[model samples]
Target: MNETSNNTVIDERSDILETLAKHRHFLRFTTRDLTDEQAGQRTTASELCLGGLIKHVTSTERNWADFIQRGPAAMGDFKNMTEADFAKRADDFRMLPGDTLAGVLAAYEEVAAATDKLVADLPDLNASHPLPEAPWFEPGARWSARRVLLHIIAETAQHSGHADIIRESLDGAKSMG
Candidate 1:
């Protein structure tokens, strides 16, 4: 069934997809009329920029979707990450050399398409995988695909708000009134 089917009853997957799409729209809207340099410009005390926010969100969504399919292996062992590893990961929050706003948005769209297909095709949302070994996650915890979807939605929504702030600070444009 369509994610936005007119039927009275909507499935959990459709709801998840719809919520995700809405947040994605808000996030992308924040980039409207921005040049590559503008998109990469840090608008506030925080290090976040519009293009970087999109880049981070795209990577995050792709990883979580992989986790839903391939278990904790999808997330590399964080316990042994070197300082350089962390520094490299931190690059996701910046628009590096040759990075363009259009390119970043294109990558996000690609990831989003793949994630949507995975959600629609997954055999069971109840299927779960162990949490990766990370300080932020509970030890020995597992997450259902449903939980991952919720997490993705939350992540997208939170970043969308951040993007709005960055966009407004960059100039006076607001994603929403």
Candidate 2:
């Protein structure tokens, strides 16, 4: 490849990697130095908790990487799926106590690996994928594989921000400099 093309590829890969790193960092941050109760504790009135966030992220990764991309979804996708019917399974996404920190992290890693492989194998970022759950998603939209990856990254980053605040409230731990 020419220097310009090489640089662009490098920049794109770097951006993707950085996004993944940030997600991993926050997962670790949220789980750090917490008792089992604290990890599972719903610190606020909302459904947010350190463990729940981890499970939610894992599910999100599987959705974007597998359901949207037409690949195999990791086991963590079923975190809170018992109450869901077949139709509800198509749209329901929540975390349950069964989704322990370790299990969720492992599932996230598996989905992340699949995501990396998908990105690497794609011929270009413009490559599009079919949306089986299209109606449940935004209006007038199908997503490219690249778009799904970026969306996962963006979603993780946003949840990480929430994790940061919750972690602080729990014990005042700051992000590493």
Candidate 3:
């Protein structure tokens, strides 16, 4: 690659890494002062709580890293999955009974590691992967692996903001910074 193209690639990668780091920072902050109950408690009507958000983020990372990029054949027949599949996945976001705060954190850590490996091993930012049969994504449109990574980073950051607000409302704790 030419110097300019090389610089662009470096810049893009840096941005992706920075976004991931920001999400991880906020996630850690949200979990900072919470007891196990507080972490798992749903303060509002929303399905997301601190722990739930962690679980959701971790699962999303795994889905993107393992299923979406690598292929979905191992997970079973996703060929005919529809909007219901998306809804079912969304409905599964809640923290189940016996899911501990530590478990959620550990899962997030593992997902983060997997995501790091995916990003590191990716050949190019523009390489695209076919979106599985899901409503949220176009059926045949390809998604760049870099874009997927960035999307995960963005999604985590957004949920971490929610966690910060919920954590504050649950108790007067404020660690959003």
Q: Judged by TM-score, which candidate is best?
A: 1
Q: Mind giving the per-residue lDDT tens digits that candidate 2 earns over 139-161?
A: 43557766777888888888888
Better of 1 and 3 by TM-score: 1
Q: What tens-digit string does per-residue lDDT give for candidate 3 at 1-177?
A: 743368777787677877797778788788885677878788888877888888888877787777546654434456576898867677446667788788889878887877776666666767666666655567686777777777788788888888888888898787644
Can you give the TM-score per candidate against the true fold?
0.94, 0.74, 0.82
Instruction: State model 3's lDDT.
Output: 0.75
Instruction: List the global CA lDDT of all models.
Output: 0.91, 0.66, 0.75
Q: Residue 21 in candidate 1 has what lDDT?
A: 96
lDDT of 2 at 118: 65
Candidate 2 regions off by >4 Å?
1-7, 71-98, 130-136
Q: For this target, which candidate reaches the highest lDDT against the unseen true structure?
A: 1
Q: Residue 95's C-alpha lDDT in candidate 3?
A: 66
The CA lDDT at 151 in model 2 is 83
For candidate 2, report its TM-score: 0.74
lDDT of 2: 0.66
Off by over 4 Å in 3: 2-5, 72-92
CA RMSD of each candidate after superposition: 3.1, 5.1, 3.3
Model 1 lDDT, residue 81, Cα = 98
**Residue 158 C-alpha lDDT in model 2:** 85
* Per-prediction tally of clashes: 0, 0, 0
